[model samples]
Target chain A: MPLPIEIVLFIFLLTTAVVIARLEDLFAAAMLTGIFSLLSAGLFTIMDAVDVAFTEAAVGAGVATVFILCTLSLTAKREYQQPTRILPFIVVGITGAALIYGTLDMPAYGDPDAVPHGHLSAKFIEIEEKAFLSQDKHAAEPAQHGSGEKAVGLPNIVTSILASYRGYDTFGETAVIFTATIGVMLLLRTRRREKKVSPPNRDQMETTS
Target chain B: MQWLGLWHYWAVIILMMIGLYIVIARDNLVKKVMGLSIFQVSVIMFYVSTGKVEGGTAPIIPEGGHDLVYSNPLPHVLMLTAIVVGISTTALALALIVRIQEAYGTVEDDELNAIDGAAL
Candidate 1:
């Protein structure tokens, strides 16, 4: 039997990751990293996380690649040679070992009895289903649950949870984006200042000459 | 059978280790950012893997359907927050890299440290 598409894509993801790690040229690494992100997005889609995949494709493969390309243009493409790698290697090795050991107690993949499935998410699903069922019986009238707006009529439960059930968290995430946008604006603000100051200095030099 | 079930996690661990090694072993600032992105991505993978169901479909409810086995949506929602955070961090890191290059004329950690050491 042939390898599953997921396994094949996973192989590609791992290969790109390794290649990105080994490449010395920052520009090439950036491109490979974009490919890695796309592959991971594919993996997310395969795992039934369509929203996550969309965000990954946009943010990871698109915005991140553009940001890195801009940074690459600003900095040298080549990396400087390092003197020693022993310590960093040992540190990474130990960390990886610890993490692998920690995974020993984790629940197996796709197990219905997994702890995450038993949480409040299950309750959310139950509520959503009940709302759907009630909607069928009350087709002639408006949903009485409008008092609480509990019937998140969206077909995508992920969207409903993200936008309604966990609206505060989404608000915080938006605030985080706003903060980062401000940080970037502040960091790169000098260019505009320089642009404004340059013409006057050049004009003064020309007059003096 | 247990080992087969755990391969997904082990692969993620390997990817995470590679990212860690890049962050630790590389001197280039931009490369470190890339490694950080990879590390975050592996974390997303870990979370998404946990959300997978054996026979699950996407979470979108079809018309008048209630028996569909949808994969866990909570992790997907949480990973959306994480994905946004990752992008923000990457953007900020890149901005910082640009500023560092402007200041030191080099993005290499050792060179920046050496210059700072000389100044001190």
Candidate 2:
């Protein structure tokens, strides 16, 4: 019997995670993390989460990996030696066991009757269903649901909710990005006059730039 | 039935544990950041998995298919914002690591702590 595609992808993902955990070389770990994100994005696509897959592909594989690579250029590529790992390992093992125990009570995958699916999401899906019916009626039938025709006129419900229903939340997220960019600029940028104090460092910086 | 239904959660839990171990055990600050990214991605997986519906396609509504089942859109939207925020957080963290390297000439947690102890 052929294994499911997700099972194959999960195997690849687990392998990458293990390799990243054991590797001492920072650069290779960074590269593998990119592969890890790309694989998860593929998994998301297989799960019918195109919007999520797109965002993960863009942010995880693209921006996060680039950031790690840039940081690597500024730091040493090798990790320092640590004396012991027994405590952290045990701690993580316990936490993992606890999380697994908690998962015993969670709703199963793709369960339409799950609590999250049965309430607000059902309402949204209902709106989409009504919209489809209205479209089928060819102007002879009005939308049965008020929210359907007024759902920001976007066929992509995720986009509509992100930009319309949850507009303020998205605005807050954008503000967070803005703040982070400013913080990065402040942390990394040095004044031109200050650069005169460290001529060799200035030259290295200029060369890298 | 049980294993097939809960496999995704178990897989996610394992990934999360690996990420947590890296964050706690790694000496290099950059590796810690990578671990944190992995942890965040694992959480995204958890939420997206919960949002899945049997026989559902992408959340995009087709032109005239009323019977079509689309996956829940709310989680996808939330995770999109989360992905953007995660990238920004990673960017800022890396910038801090760069500054830490410049100041202490080391990115190892122990070395930085030792340097601080000496100064104190």
Candidate 3:
């Protein structure tokens, strides 16, 4: 019962992806990209990644789409039709085939005993377990609040891991965001005066600025 | 043999290849970026798939009790940061595109190349 919608969402995702790849109109493609992001967000939710889904819906579907439309306004709307090339198709096929062959060793989807679950994930889960599920009757040691070690003190284990365990990565992420801001500002700066030239001749438009 | 179990990974791979194909094959810069977005999201899907447990719920600690299996939180955290980074990349790429459009007056890869070839 739970998986029926899950499968449907994946199907929708695949469909939207193909359509996006084939569509030539940049406007429609940008809109479909938003649809694709929302569909992927739905898939994320079904896979129990609510936080990821929320962020994807907001950033991927919401902000990315708007930014794209903004770019579209400032640039060409219709993509110029070029003769299709086969070499890239062959390259994608070969890479995809190799990747598929590699997946044979990957753990099955939703496998609880997969290697990732055994390491730090289990401990992260246990930390929260000790807090709320003190009466856990599993083979693990009884929830001895034996030491004064406080539970993560937050309900969401994801946040605790991100803020504390992986704080350095978050710092790096912040730095990355800051650097991106600087890059955007530098790239978009129009320093010289602009001529009222036609949009097609925009190459020299920024030169005067 | 166990294709049924690995179907999700297969689809993810296909999606990735589609994204790669768009990046490699398409002449339009914006479409390539769209493909890049799809590719990034598909990778996110793969990692999130690995984070899922058969009977697991979201990685939030529940108030009533703790018998429920919570999916792996590490992947979610990593992917959260990844999504943020992804948007940043997209933003930065779009900025570059805007600059490219201004300087070349076109976003087509071949056209831009032609422009450069003429200059040389």
Candidate 4:
């Protein structure tokens, strides 16, 4: 029998993980990492959690990979020595085990009777059409009385939430990007004195006799 | 075969862990960064995989109103923004790498550390 899609996705994820683990070269690993991200994004499409997938694809796959590659280029690719740390690994293992134990009480994946489906989600899906219609009716009545165009313009609730309801968060995120940019510029910029001492300066004086 | 259902998620988690391990354990700066990439990609995979529905197709609205099952479009939309962010990050990082290469004679972590130590 053909494997279930989830299983297949799992296999892909596992394979990528193993590959990433064994890879020695930094560049190759970075590229593989990108492939892993893309594959994960594909898996997310299969799952139906579009929003999380989107963030993963953008930040995890795109930006993070690029950042890694950039850092790699700045540093050496090969490890000079093997890690001898055992205590940290043990600590990590213990922590992970504890977390997994905590998750045992959580609902199974896609259980129709799960709390999320039974509560808010089912209600939202059931009433979405009615909500849209009511908004439409309200929009039809109120061009002069209120800003009708602004009220029902965006289709996706998440978008509206991001852009309007939580606009401050968005503004903060933008500020973060701006800060990062400035930080990079400040970190990378050379002083005037450093810039003036070209490689040829010492060589030229020595050659002139 | 029997364990297929939940195994995929576990696999993703494993991959993520391995990637993270490389990032933290490796002494080479480049290797560490590569590990970071691996870690990030695994997370993307984990999120994307969570969005799948059993029998769903792509979320594109079919022409002429034919009733067809489609995947959710929200993930795709979110992914576009992510791609843009990724590109921007990559550009900035690469620029930093170029600068680092110019400043340091070698990119080896140990050598850099030694140079830094000497400077101090």
Candidate 5:
């Protein structure tokens, strides 16, 4: 068989990750990270996920890298060495092993015979025609049993899931962002106050000396 | 290799793991962010690869061919929104990093931690 597309994409992704991991210089690593993101976006496009690829190219490869670079400019580039801690590694290994074992009990990817197909998905597919008709008729009925096909019309399930089905969660997430912004503003404001207050204390110390 | 058919997926997974490792293991803040970007890209690759059908054509509707086998367009649509979200996240993250630098004086986690400890 020809080289599978997944394998090729995998190799590319793995190489990018390894390159980023192995690099010692912080700036070079950040640039490589951006390259990795771009490559991943290409991989996404090939996989037929153009929208995600676009996002990855623009955000992962573009904005995130720029942010990292800006932060690097204000910091030392050298890595600090520390003694290795083994306890966390052991816990991680055990957790990972358990997760892998759990996955073995799950359905294989793209398996048409999987239980998911025979479950609610089958009902959804079978009722899809009726759902469309009901939507056309604009009949008043319980929203829960309806096709949930509104997600398709929205052109984005993730957004629909966030903004509609889980609107409350999205609202909470927005609140969290707002809260964090407020916290930052407060902390920064206090820092300015401290700077102003410190001058008087320094002057007093100098007079006593 | 008995599992050659799934090698591509495995490779993507490995790449993701490597990226994650770098993010976790590196001490340099920039390197950590770079690793995070790599990890995120790996996820994007995984999502995109799932849309591929063995012999399907582009998802675009054909003008004349009645028997055209178009790939599923759902994944592509989802990816577009994902891209937008990713961009938004990246912009926000960069802004945070800029603020962090201004406040902390140094971006190195260890140094920042020491400064914080002294302040406390």
Candidate 6:
């Protein structure tokens, strides 16, 4: 039933990517990248990643588009056309071919017995069920919970694992975002002081390009 | 030849290759970053695809909903946080692009290289 929709969305994804590639107007390209991200978010939704879809729509499509547009305002609007480079094409082709060849031995899509679904995810899902179960049991006792009966007591499995089981990794992710914010802020801030370092001597500078 | 099962991966591969080509072939710094974004998202798609079970729904378990199969939420959590973090880093990248444009006249790779070669 939904497979057709998935195929259609995947096709649109490919089409949008191609259009973005062919587009020369930097502004339109930025807009198309947002569209591409939005399409990918829809694909995520179809694949049952509701939270992933939400974040992709908001961050990937929304904030990212705005950032790209802001940068375009500061820089040139049209991409400078260069002569066709065969080396890059060859490189991409080889890498893509290798990746395709690598996937040949992988399990079929949506196979219930696939490695990821069979291992840690199965345990996590059971934990999620238990968490939900304890929520129901909470109405009866209301005191016996959160010690051992309830593990990662969030109704949403993704949030449960993210906040509890994977807390350290999420902390690292937050740290990365914090560092990026600091980097951006430092880069964009206006300096009030004059140049600190001495200018490079013109005698030593040579035209090498 | 399970074409029905494998075609999705192949299509994703093509999309990924397009992004890779753009990153390598495009001289525009902003465009390269966008290509890099595409590449990263494709990886998420590949991982999420692996987490799907045939009859699985989203991983939000309701009260007494244990009988229902749920898609693996690990990839969803990883990719969700990753999307946000990726955008934060991309914002930093764009900020650097803005600084590069201010210091130099263009964001083209070769032009920037040319400017660097000729000046101290």
Q: Write out the backbone clash pairs for model 2.
A: none
Best by TM-score: 1
Which digits, one per residue and each the tens of the lDDT, describe model 6 over residues B12-72?
A: 8988999998898999999999998998889888888877778999999877765898999
Candidate 5 residue lDDT tens string, B1-120: 434344445555666666666656665566666666565665655555554555545444323334443344444544554455454454455556556777786666777789999999
**Stretches of candidate 4 above 4 Å error?**
A1-3, A51-71, A77-92, A112-129, A133-139, A142-153, A191-209, B1-9, B40-120
TM-score of each: 0.92, 0.90, 0.89, 0.65, 0.62, 0.90
- The alpha-carbon deviation from the true structure for residue A76 of candidate 5, after best TM-score superposition, in angstroms, is 3.1
Candidate 4 lDDT score at position A48: 62
- What candidate 3 gets wrong by more than 4 Å, as runs, is A132-151, A192-209
User: Recovered native contacts in candidate 5, as a fraction?
Assistant: 0.32
Provide i-RMS per model in Å. Answer: 1.5, 1.6, 1.7, 5.1, 5.6, 1.3
Query: What is the DockQ (computed on Cα atoms) for candidate 5?
Result: 0.27
Q: Which candidate model has the greater TM-score, 2 or 4?
A: 2
Write candidate 6's Cα lDDT for A53-75 as tens digits. 88888887889999999999999
- Share of reference contacts kept by candidate 2: 0.88
lDDT of 3 by residue, A1-209 (tens): 23788778888988888888888999999999999999999999988999999999998889999999999998889898777788998999999999999989998888889999988899878876676555444436645456755455467888888888788999999999999989988788654323455665666655654
Name the docking class for model 4. Answer: acceptable
Ranking by DockQ: 2, 1, 6, 3, 4, 5
> lDDT values of the candidates?
0.86, 0.86, 0.87, 0.55, 0.56, 0.84
Model 3 residue B22 CA deviation (Å) reads 0.8
Report the C-alpha displacement of residue B23, candidate 6, in angstroms.
0.6
> What TM-score, to 2 decimals, does candidate 6 have?
0.90
lDDT of 5 by residue, A84-166 (tens): 55554555456445544444554434333545335433343233334434434464753236544442223233343346545
The sequence of per-residue lDDT tens digits that candidate 2 reaches over residues A1-209 is 11389889988998999899889888999999999999999999977889899888887888788889989988998786567669999999999999989988988888888888777787777775666556666656555545434544457888878888889999999999999999998887776455676888778877886
- The whole-model C-alpha lDDT of candidate 2 against the native structure comes to 0.86
Model 6 steric clash pairs: none
Q: Evaluate candidate 3 and give its CAPRI docking class based on DockQ.
A: medium
DockQ of each: 0.76, 0.76, 0.73, 0.28, 0.27, 0.73
* lDDT, candidate 1, A1-209, per-residue tens: 11398789888988998888788878899989999999999989988899999999988889899989988998998887666668988898899889888887888777778899877877777677667666777776666486674667567889889999999999999999999999999999865665676788967765885
Model 6, residue A186: displacement in angstroms? Answer: 0.9
- Model 4: per-residue lDDT, tens digit, B1-120? 433344445665666676667656555555655565555555555444443444654433223323333333333444444444444554455556556666876655667789999999
Residue A173 displacement in candidate 3 (angstroms) = 1.0
